[model samples]
Target: MPAPVLLPPTSYDYVTVHKVQGTTITAASDILAAEEPLEIRLGFGPTGQREHRTLAITMRTPGHDFELAAGFLLTEGIISRRQELHGILYCPDVEKVEERENVVRAELASTVPVALPRLERHFYTSSSCGVCGKTSIEAVQAAACPVLPTDGPYVAAELLHQLPERLRAQQELFEQTGGLHAAALFSPEGELLLLREDVGRHNALDKVIGAALLQEWLPLHQHVLLVSGRVSFELVQKAAVAGIAVLAAVGAPSSLAVQAAHNFGLTVCGFLRQGRYNVYSHPWRIVGAATAGL
Candidate 1:
């Protein structure tokens, strides 16, 4: 196994001034940079077998790299849970550091092929745009998974309205650079369970899901997920795979996300700010909210 190459952090230079003895004096500056890369690699092989097959590569910030890999595999329907991942390691055969590039290969327990569509919509070098590789809206419809419901949980208006702030407060990267997106999970009681942040919104969700998988908490059927960005079809898809019943977004959801939620019987809420939000699907879960006024 090859050692993980961690990238450095991003930083910015700043200066401060002081006024003493009726005179102004100024200090200096600093340098800042963050760890970021595109990890690329292939799928599973025999236990002692090591044949490299081209899987997928994604450009991302470097912390929790393993989680990123596992999450990518799970969300793509490649593997269902953390147990499916036998091992994840860099290709040690390559000699030169440059050869490593942004590649990371994951080995699964089985020799099965991932069942996702052949379309390349999910692969991307960046997250500025959400799920940019699909062929058509109808294609998404075809892959639209069935929703499973257990019990309907009601969320209070005050708690539903305050999720954005709680999610925002947990985003350390956003607080510093103001450039990242975040995703969080909360119990039905509105207790914050876990949170993740990334340069991309989808990646943020993946990291959170990946963490949950590592913890053996899949099919988040009883949990509520919140996103710092808008809700998209892909985000809804990810939520569905995690079995999350409710998805709240700080921004508005696209038409496709709404449709996906409707088809899957998910609870989708957007524009979650200023004590207001719009429910796109399964509105019954969000009880006692002043939704009519919105």
Candidate 2:
């Protein structure tokens, strides 16, 4: 394989639309989030005899695709570290010119083992659903996701309060189309480190994690992760797998998400806005929280 080419895909597209308000219709241009299927392929086996397999196909906005592929593989337990990956590149032999950028191939080092049967459940994923394609509950718990350490990255309530506004301000695509979800990485002191956007919340986080992994920043035990929307079990699982200490969201968290967070010893904060938020589990990580009664 040749050196991977970085082709920037358009994240949004403009279309002519009729604006109707109070029965008055006017033609105007509207921006919409671009959703397309990204095919993630893996090349594994040995140096002399490598095998290619289609790993997954996800519906996501077309940008930062390389990061998305790397992140997906990491969260899915395909490759645990950046060293396991040989390279990630667009498929050079795509059948169509327009589809060249739609496919990404992740080359894995021969030293890495391949387990295709365990990952069959992830054949197809949509923008709206992350883990719905799961075949069994056992499969979901089988990944080698670690339990987070109890050490302190102790974040202040005041610092947490300011994160949503900071995350919102950096969401360039969301500001334009209002149809994209975002995932951001923040320091314990509330500094915005990195942000990724996509039609699917999972993909956005994958891109963020992928970038971190590529940049050799795994085991994010001292960092914070914030998502734009409600928290799901898949999101919790991903955050934990990446070794994120605190997972915050602008909206509420699901019951399973809270349970998983508690089990993994991760700090979960939901409804994080308006100078207040709910700490669902492991409140001890939040500085000045009274953990005596609970």
Candidate topping TM-score: 2
Q: Name model 1 segments beyond 4 Å from true.
A: 1-35, 47-50, 93-102, 114-146, 290-294
lDDT of each residue in 77-195, candidate 1, tens digit only? 66766677777777766666864645677777765455334314445433334443344334444453335574665677578877777777666666756666788998887888887
TM-score of 1: 0.78
TM-score (all chains, Cα) for each model: 0.78, 0.91
Segments in model 2 whose C-alpha atoms lie over 4 Å from true places: 1-9, 124-142, 289-294
lDDT of 2 by residue, 1-294 (tens): 122223243888899999999999999999998999999988999889999888888999999999999999888888889999999999989899999899999999999998777456566544235554334224445675655777777998778888888888877778889998899998898878888899899999999999999999988988999999999888988898899989999999988888887777889999988878999999888986445565
CA RMSD of each candidate after superposition:
6.0, 4.5
Error of 2 at 59 (Å): 0.5
Model 1 root mean square deviation, Cα atoms: 6.0
Candidate 2 lDDT:
0.85
How large an RMSD does model 2 have? 4.5
